[model samples]
Target: MKVEYKKASLGDIQVMQELVDPEVESGVILERSSDEMATNIRSYILAYVDGKLAGFCALHIHTASLAEIRSLIVDETHRGNKIGANLIYKCVDEAKTLGLQKLLSLTYRQSFFENLGFVEIQKESLPEHKIWADCIKCKHFPICNEVSLIKNL
Candidate 1:
């Protein structure tokens, strides 16, 4: 299987939404509107396998020193291909290139992020700015069950 990775384009918004729907239903990822995705489109990285969109992820830089890996979803049929790992590596590369010091992820899949070198952490350890700016807007705020993990880059 041939795999290619590229920055997301405006045209990919619908497919991106489609790819993330199941995860959203299962609460693995937050639901994103097309407008939101379009606004942050540049942060997204898309993976294509044999000319089809297989998965996608986003590297959201919250501050100069911190960034979060968000919206990582691999199509069910595309599992086990390492596409998810590669998408994360791509995010890591971007974070490093931009001189970010840390990457954070809030996920239910602790072992998966741990395998990629992220260490489990308390959500309170995250910056207050992040809490007020992003977490506050989440429907699960203040009582979310997702695990927090960080990787110093």
Candidate 2:
């Protein structure tokens, strides 16, 4: 399973949408419009396996030293292949390249992130900009059930 992780292009939006749809529908992740994703294409990294889209992760910069990992999804058929981990690694690598000191995520899969060295944290610890920009739009809003996790880059 040769997997390549690279920055996502505008052309990859549809494939990325499909990869994330299941989680969205299940309410495990928030739904994002294709247009919104296209606009933020440069913030994303996609994983390709044998020339097919296998997974994706996005690192959205919220401040000079902080970034949030968003929209991490792996194809259902390709789960358990370490593709998700690779996508995460790509996001962390990009964060390092950009001189970011922290990466955060609001996720249901706490143990999975814990295994990757992300520590569970209080959502309030995150910069207010992140909440104002993104989380406010989330249906979960003030009642968000997702656990907040952070990793020092």
Model 2's number of clashes is 0
Q: Per-residue lDDT for 16-122 in model 1, tens only?
A: 99889888877668888899999999999999999999999999988889999999998888989999999999999999999999999999889999999999999
Compared with the true structure, all predictions reach lDDT values of 0.92, 0.87
Q: Any runs in candidate 1 off by more than 4 Å, and if so which?
A: 136-139
What is the C-alpha lDDT profile of model 2 across 1-153, one tens digit per residue?
Answer: 788888889888888888888888887777889889988899988889899998888899888898999988898889999888888888888899999999998899999899999999997787877778777777777788999999998
- Relative to the true structure, candidate 2 reaches a TM of 0.93
What are the models' TM-scores?
Answer: 0.94, 0.93
Error of 2 at 89 (Å): 1.0
**Regions of model 2 farther than 4 Å from truth:** none
lDDT of 2 at 20: 86
Each candidate: RMSD to true structure?
Answer: 1.3, 1.3
Tell me how far candidate 2 lies from the true structure as C-alpha RMSD in angstroms: 1.3
